[model samples]
Target: MNIPYAIPECRVAHLVERHHDHLVVPVRLDAATGCCPECGHASRSVHSRYHRQPADLPLSTSQTKLRIEVRRFYCLNPTCRRRIFAKTPTDLLAPHARRTRRLGEAQARVGLACGGAGGARLLAHLHMPASRATVLRLVTRMPMPDTPAPIRVGIDDWAIRKGSRYGTIVVDLDRHRVVDLLPDRTAPTVAGWLERHSSVALVAWDRSTEYARGASLGAPQAQQVADRWHLLTNMRQAVERWLHGAHARLRSLPLLPGSTVRPARRNRAFARSTTELEAAAQSRMRWQVVYDEVRHRHAAGKPLLAIARALGLARATVRKYASAETFPARLPHGAGPSLLDPHVAYLAGRIDEGSENAMALWREIREQGYPGTSRQVHRFVAERRTRPVRSGRKPRSAKASASEPPGSETLLPPARQLAWLLVQPTSVLNESEAAVVSRVEQDDTARAVTGLARRFTALVRAAGKGNPVADDRDAAADIEAWITKARTCEAPAIATFASGLEADIAAVRAALMEPWSSGQAEGQVNRLKLIKRQCYGRAGLNLLKRRMVLAA
Candidate 1:
């Protein structure tokens, strides 16, 4: 040591072992093994060493590689006169396999956890041979969460794709995490799942019947709370239905068929400019002429059916163009010298003279034998604030009066405008539109419309009045009464649709009474629908079910 100690070489570079049950195998061996791995034989003499290739994690800009100098041993045991064998590790994968154990696990996740096709693609991208089936296998291996009996559980269904088929999804209401996905959305399948997990105390679900059936059958003691947002949505649909029936006769009804129906391309659509428009109009005129010729022929003792057949026209289309009600609504002639009629000259003279106060003018007009109300006068005057130009281009109408030119200066009075606004719907109606409604609705149905408009206006005013909010408790009670009336209309569909909700209306009402809302959950349902569609691309039931439950 005093002279200089020679450094001893390290023989053992690394070691990797594989364990199977009670057996341990040295898959990767160090250079120096004092004792034999296959047999207990000590050796000080070095017999031989060779490189053993093993899989490793990929390195940056390089494919991963591992080389180990595994030891070869000589069993000097007289009883065991056999050659020593090189050991293989069970923890390590088989030779020639590129993937490591952990990498395989992650691949399984790509297949099992994500949507099947997506998982397949992802794994393939990662150089894994994962098919949709392989992905499905991974899903099968995942353990179902042992969700504790949640006080409030949410039940719904997600299809693999839109219109493909659906599977029941249960969520832990308290945790807001997915609990279990069932095989089908049918009553029996979902019911079986619920019966197995029977301690659920409360359930929140949509207005779907099968889920309700399953819930009623499986969790009889559970209190059901229907999604209120859905209830309100149903109410809205009902209102829209009424509106559709009420306004059915309006000419501008949006008659485009369901999105699936395609409209024939009009030649006019390709035209871009006024010249093109004129050309398109001429083409339309030509068709109109043909149609009129057929009609006149029919009217002058020739048969319509014969004329239509001779002209190669679809009989129904022929009738549509020829016999259609040419005059729908008759325009009212000279209703009056509208408060509008005076706006241009009146506001122009006043504003020109620096005496224009539309509000004051509204009152003056009301006093000056103007049949219309102050609100109408105000609205008319207010509309002219744009100070539109009177272009020297062709005049649009002979109806444009001296006082009420097509382009005129307008004035508005604050009180009069507000009065006009009170006559309109509380929602969606613009101020100008509201004013028009205020003026036009002054006829036969005006009073009823006015009463409703006023009530809504009062409600709005009260909201903005900084007045202490009166107790809406009575109002809420009245809504409940209305709800009861609405329920009577649903007794037939109620047996199916409104059953779970109806039976649980008390609980639902309680849920509604709570400050919390089911809006988010309902929104989640919609999101699920979108997800289902994207994942499955309109798949069949089994495929759809698989996609929905397994999709990421």
Candidate 2:
């Protein structure tokens, strides 16, 4: 049977073999002269012939294998390193390759789309089985398309092993593609990469001192722009710190005349269970014994290492205990296995359905495979029965006036929540949230910080839209005004933040004026994380880089 499309530059000679799962077709190249690879000279003199078999793309549901009759030819030119050469079909297969070029291309596409294991599984389903390693090999061997040096780029670090190891990623913000991945986040490493690609003009990055130094050293001509998101984040953190510092004063402030203050609700789930309480007590006793020993030894002028050796504790632990003024609180052991855990959902459903009798529930669970005694179920039920139900009326102090507005009796939320509200625009807040903002603004420090935060937010928003507040000078003036107000405010948190902003004033100004940002680079980092997780964290740096560049 004739098979014209079986392989390039070859025709099927005959059906050599057939099996239940696959078929083998013997094919021969149309007689022709091939160029000598070493000298680029065409030669037709036949030297030898041999059969070579290679796997091809699946034919319908069965695998197809091509058995080709290959030939050897003698070099015709005398100066062409005169010798014999194999006449393999270059377009059909690469030298010594076990699969056809088309099949390899298909496998590579699978690898590119789904990665290693996923690609292997997909190929197997498509009747083109290949191992995960093979798929990755094909992907790595695929040539990457060349990209020119980017003009505007963003640089940021991603963790290889979080907190211990990190690498840098450079992205072309204009084209929205990855430029390259650096092996380390060090200044010299990034600087070296930047020096090689001298086309970089503007570099937007986070407020990392290492990256700042690298950008300066590598691409000194490039203007560095701080990330807007990071700037806002820093400002928010400062506001939170200020609020934390003023927590006591804020708590003592009067909500209304004659109003009393109530303590915040405690998390019942966070409370230690009976078993955990016992474990914590034992742990505390053990730590106390160690702490007393360390203190005694330290008082006797024993070295930390000597104390550690004598006590069989780590030197750091010994030093920590020696310097500590009081015994550290022991953390409670985590919840252990319980008979009720497996039946918790069932118990909840039963309670919701009005089955409140612990005895009946216990019997029902027993029928469903529970082994616990009825007494345990009764205790769980009793706890649930005694749990407090929150009332609609907000808790208030007796000193608060009875004439206070409805829903105005509650004390302010935690400082963090209050800071979050302050960060958001008042226009987007609902009535209650707006009221909270008003109450917070009544505090002189909060009000001043809130105003400055809103103005900075507006500046950032305007810069994002390419319509910054006036020109760069006016924008600088606005920043200066905000900083001045912040530094003078009663809130120490805001003042501390302002001092930091003053130190990085140039980067902050660039952040508010420059159109460039590390937004794209951050997005690519997220993409890298996803790819890393998909590979189950087994891929190395080189493999990850290859995948990212080719996939990008």
Candidate 3:
């Protein structure tokens, strides 16, 4: 039978033997001499003969194994350190290996694409059986391809263990491939990496000071460019923060002609139980006391450790309280969606139709496949019924009531929602969003904030599109002018944000001029996260680094 595989200097001697699901092919070496690996001496005299069986790729529906008849030749050179050497096809298989070179490569690729256990399950179905451990071993033994030197690179931090540990991912911006992964996001770690890649002429990063310092220390000749996306993101956050403090104004803004407005309660106690209000007030007061004490202690030159100890609080908590420019509001508790959520629209329709009975509403929903109890429907009806009732008021005529739509109530957008509308381009805003924007713009402070946010967004988009600039100096001047306006603006949050930009002026300016950004680096981080999840936490940093650098 002819040999299906290309085994150098070898020939198929015996016919294929089929045993259950296995197919074995006996192979014989045809080489006349063997070379000594120790001294490079060739010998033709044979000392012994033996068989070495190694697994190969599957054949049809059966696992194939090559039973290679190998010869052990005596070294002709007495000066050689080795007494004997094996005559085998080195190109086909590695010494002391149980699989051919081609087979090992296939398994390594499988291991990389599908992690350990996943690869093993896949290989078993393909008739090339291997354990998870074996698959990982193949992946580790596989050599890494050499990467070309990079001219432009972007660095970003990725969460290894979110909210706690983080690592750095370095991507070659020009080639659009990951170059290396660091164990930590520290400046020293990043600097050491950059120092090794001296070919890098430009380094793109975020507004992080650690990355900025690292690039400066490692590659001073390389110009650092801040990511444009991150700049806009930070601006959006500043707008949101400012809106949080000025949210009361948003409530008083005039509603659109057809917009819904929330009805006010005559009795404030009806909004929430008196007990709930008192509890919330007491909680807020406690937070205010702690917040004030922490700020005062910090202002008086007290260390975070001392403050935490004195307050019986964690260092992180104390530090958070001290770092805030404004007091952090306690987040309201929001309940998760219930089994009754899908039936809310149906329930509302019944309620508006004058069906006030909770059991009746529950029965109607149950017919529609709602699995929740009547108590859930009862709570919903009770909340809606708690609005203050008018005593002895004249009822509206049927014609007057029919003029307005049913359930139409005035609803004011929240501060967070308003902040988003302000920063977004007008072209993307819908009719309702545009109406909200128009109303907010009526106030001088809101209009100014909106103008500055829109202008900043436009600048970043223009820079990102790589439009031809009239002059680098002109673009810088525009940015500088915007910064000046933002710094002296009435909004303190935005002013502080603008001051931070002025502090990182060099990198920010480079961001406007250079086309390179960390966008591709962020994409690589996403891919890394996928691979990390595949490992199921069994793989360590070294293995993860190998898979990321090698896998597609």
Candidate 4:
């Protein structure tokens, strides 16, 4: 029979013995002399021949094994480590390995694609059975790939533990591949990596002080482009901050079409119609008082730490209250419509009919297709009991019954939501959203802030259009004019944000002119997050770095 497998510089005498689902082929080495792997000395004197069995790729439907007659050679150089060495073919097989180079490589690739246990199952189906541990070992043992030096790199930070630990990922924007994953996001680490890669001509990153300082220290000649996405994000956050002070106005707007708008509460009073809302409103009023006091103390030249200790509040809380331009309301949790919404009318009717037993009320609502728990019903009845209305009188529904004046109920769109509606393109807004935005813009302060925000958005987006206007002094002049206008705006947040831009004016200008962005690095960080979650607690940074860098 023809040899099932071939080996160069060796003679294969195939004696195909198909016994019990195994294919065995015998082969012999053709070379007269074998070199000692350690000493590199060629010795023709053979000690003794031995039968060696090593697994190979499956042949047809059966597992294949190579039974080779190999000779051990004595190391001629006495200076070298004294011993007999096997005539191992470095190209065909690794020393002491039970599989061929090709087979091991295939298994490693499988391990890379499907981690550990998954890879083992896949390998078994492919007729190349291996344990999950073996597959993982193969993956870990694989060498790191050598990529060409990067020219323009994008860098961004990824959370290892959100809000606590973070690491930086660098991507080659031109090649669109991850260059390296730093262990930590710090100035020294970033600078050290960039210093080694002198070929880097540009570094694109978010407006992080560490990265900016690092790039300046390591690659002073390279142009640093602040990411445009981060710029727009900062601008949106500023708008949101400004809107926080105008939250009452937002609540007053007749935005929701079918819903009733509640009469606006004046002077932070706890005069809400419902007991639950009244409690919530009272809580807000209490916090608002604290906020006012904190600001008063700060204005009196008291330190934040001292004020925090005096008021029994955290320093961070005191600082936030002190710096806020207006009282920031903590919107009630579960602000969305409740499960009891559809059955509110039925519950209220049963209550009016003298069915005060919470259990009886819950059963009635449940039979009427209410999915909410009995606890919700109990809470609803408890609130009604606290109200001073006549016992026989009909209770108002949670939404305020139709007997109340039209527009007596309102839902406040979050400041973040309002900021997005203002900054985003008008063409994308739905009819209702467009109408609300139109009303919002009618306010003088909202109109001014919105105009500046839209202009900044356009200027940043224009960079993607390859507009020469962004590259010229015209963009600079326009941005300067916008900043000047923003500084004079009634919104303190917008003015503060403008001051920030003025401080980092150089990078802001580069963001408008340069097309390169940290977007690629952000994409890689997303991929890294996927890989991290897959292996989650099972792998360490070494394995994660290997998988991210080498797998790509």
Candidate 5:
């Protein structure tokens, strides 16, 4: 800012007063000066005058100074009887400040950017010097941003001291900065803030019901925009739920599949040029072979136990594949030529040749180099006898054996039948369980639903965990830890779930702990000081604040 100076007569405004910290202006007063600023009392005699400090532009090259003619006046009103008062100026100042308004604002920028010490160091590097304490005081005392009421607001909670306390940071979506903060992220606390500042047209927040309750309470008219991230998080937790609920069903474990290949340790031997999709496809391909072999053996009357042992896998994993079929198992009712496709021709020819017993077929198969165990050969040959009367005697024993589940325990993927069995209640029969597991493993729709159910149940279970009987107060501490994990997720649904669980968030966080808060917003205020420090070789406070906000 440039002040036009005069000594009764000036050629022109030759000197442009530029302020690096703040700008100052001179005001003249005499017995005939102007109206009294305080008490509305008229004054007529002047005490004395000099240039009083006023706000100026910080970061200016020249040591810009305010040349104000300060004055003391006597109240003429008999009723008031005041002796003398220092007349105040119109621009920016509280009372008794030696620094100008511009200078104070400048201090705010520097203090907030680099912090006190950093700002002080940088300021000293410039012409005008000040202590870190002075800079910090300005940062604290300066007014926060106060734009008028907003139509749309965003509410969220963030941790100040994680697992201990949380604070709410509200933002006017339209302006996009700090609106206000609540002491706690609880429903009522946030609701109160909303009620006080209630013009919000929309409340965009993560899926936490605390904020939801607050939004409902404070800004009843506002529409809630549940963040997509929150929704996904909730959905994922829901899937985990089904996994938990299905835990009991996993009783009959199978063998796990092992990898046949390993990555090369030498950099030069590694395949670096592969694309992401190609690499993923190869990874899938590795498991696909094992999956195919397992399914084939399952269909061929080789029990999961034998195959898992042969393949060196956990029984549970073998069961997983075997039970890949959807729940509510379907009956093997197809009217095929034989129960076994590849074995049917052999069975028909053997039956035609009058070789009827299981021993004869097993003996014949052994001569053909069957590497698998004899029991599988028996099961397959017996399956042939169970078909119908037109070809041969269809034995009830053979039929029952076909329907029976392979009790071999290795953690393998369940056959379509076993998957349904795993999801069923324990009260059911093995045959019925097998049928149901088969149904579930086959129906994509049912499987999808169960997956979601599993995840949700898991999350709930996780949330409920506290000091279990196994632990002491550590159980309570454990619950708090889980909730903290839930809160930190950037996804809205996850945060919202954690928020909704606010009531049961745990004993430790029950009081001072915050799951979410706007401490980062406050941190940004401090960061503004660092940014200012880095660039404050010479800069104005207004420019600094603007830069900090924009850059941030």
Candidate 6:
């Protein structure tokens, strides 16, 4: 019988046995003589013979095991220390190994692609039985190809366990491949690795102090470039903070003339549907009972804890009620901002003009860039119709008095939404959004912040697109000018944010001047997360590193 071509060094002598799910083939080495390991002497004289069993790759959907008759040869040289040496098939199987080299190679590849448990399941599907631990061992034993020194690199941190432990991933930006994964996200760990790769010319990263310090210590000659996306994101967060602080002022601003004005009447139907009044009354009654009990207990000279235990209240609650202060009003949770906000005024106008059909209003707004449901419009219209009108003489205009600031009645969008609006290019905003943004820009503080934000965005776009404005000296000067403006601007939040940028000015300047970015590094981190999650977070760092480098 002829053996398969995969194990060509051995020829099949005969079929030894056949079972329901497995086939056993007895084979022998085709070579007439074997070479001695110690002296490289070829010997044909056999000392003894033994049967060896090793598992081979599956044959025709059935498990195949080879029962080979291996021979032990006596050394012909008199001076040789070894008397007898066993003949082993180097191409078929390693010494003392239970499986063929080809089968082990396939298992290792499967382990690299899918992690241990996943790979085991996959192998089972292919009728190649292997355990998760075996697959993991094969993966760890797999060799890694040597990589060249990186000239342009990006570094970023990824969570091993989010909010608890994190590690760093280093990427070769020019090659667009991950180079190494450090054990921890500390300065010493990163610095130790960077010190070994002195050929790195440019290092791109986010505003992480640990990375900055490590890069400076290890690769002082390398230019450090901060990510433009991170810089813009930080600036947006600062703008949002300032907007949140100014929310009260924005709430008091008067609406512009001819703007859709909401009447100050209670919605009886909405109140009934929500049971809001009943909830408030129950809360008030509960708090009042607690307050009366606490005051009585305090007057009786009972300790706070005793009063708490007697009344089944927490000590903190009892102390709060015992304190002589006015009852604090419970504020209702605010509704989240909706995409339909910009068109709500237009919807109200259409309803006032006697087009009370909600579906028609939804279609009109859809044409005007409203990305919301007709159900939301229907709810709005239904509530508006149930407003309780005042039964008296004709009311005065709902517009604010001249003493009030113009546009005060128009509440600004939430901080995040307002920040998004401010950062958006004016050409993209609809008529209503543009007007709102224009009104906000009229404020000196808001105008200063918006101007700085726009300038920074232009710089980033220019750098990303390789425009001429990204010239190192020119970009540096522009950044300095913006920082000066920020410091002098009336917005304290903007000034604080600028101060932080000034401290990291070198990295920030590199961000504007150099074309390299941490974008590629960030992408690698995301890929790492995917691989980590695939293993159900059971694979260790060494196993994960092998998968990342080899799989890439």
Over 11-47, each residue of candidate 2 has an lDDT whose tens digit, in order, gives 8788657888887888889868877889988888999
Give the distance in Å from residue 304's predicted Cα in candidate 4 to where it truly belongs: 7.6
List residue ranges in candidate 6 displaced over 4 A. Answer: 1-4, 15-18, 258-409, 468-470
Best by TM-score: 3
Tens digit of lDDT per residue, candidate 5, span 358-381?
666766665665444555445544
Candidate 4: tens digits of C-alpha lDDT, residues 1-552: 676466655576766788797788777877889888887889998888887788888888777777878888888898998579878556666778899878888998988877788889998888888998998899899999889999999999998777678989999999898888888989999999999999999999898989998998888988898999999999998888777668766556545455323322221221134666678768888998899999899999999899998999987577557656677766533234578767767777777877777788899888988987898787677555424345655443433434233433344456778899889888889866776677787678988888899889888888867773635587789789889999999988899899988877777888888788899998898888888777754767777787787788
Candidate 5 overall lDDT versus native = 0.52
Per-candidate total of colliding backbone pairs? 8, 5, 7, 7, 124, 7
Name every residue pair that clashes in candidate 3.
Answer: 260-409, 260-410, 260-411, 261-409, 261-410, 261-411, 262-410
- Please provide, for model 1 over 1-552, each residue's C-alpha lDDT reduced to its tens digit, 9 standing for 90 to 100: 011111122122334233331111123343344565555677655567676554344332223334544555666766765666543333544455544455556665665445667788876555455577766665555544444566667777665444566676776667765566666788888678778877787777776667777878888887666665555444333332222222212222222223211223211111133465467668767776776676677677776588777898876555444443341111212223344454445556665665435578876656766666565544344433334324443322221233242212221112223335434355767645554444433442333334433443343334333442345564345335444544454222222223434555554554444433334445456756665554565434444344334443
Question: Residue 409 of model 3: what lDDT?
Answer: 39
Better of 1 and 5 by TM-score: 1
Query: Clashes in model 2: which pairs?
Result: 258-399, 258-400, 259-399, 259-400, 260-397
lDDT of each: 0.49, 0.78, 0.81, 0.79, 0.52, 0.79
Query: What is the full ranking by lDDT, best candidate first?
Result: 3, 4, 6, 2, 5, 1
lDDT head-to-head 1 vs 2, winner = 2
C-alpha TM-score for every candidate: 0.46, 0.73, 0.82, 0.78, 0.44, 0.76
- Quick one: how many clashes does candidate 3 have? 7
lDDT of 3 by residue, 433-539 (tens): 88878878877888899999999998888889887346789878988999999998888878989999998888888888888899999999988888888998677
Name the candidate, 1 or 4, with the larger lDDT value: 4
Better of 1 and 6 by TM-score: 6
The regions of model 5 sitting more than 4 angstroms off are 1-34, 37-44, 49-69, 73-80, 83-88, 92-94, 144-146, 241-446, 449-552
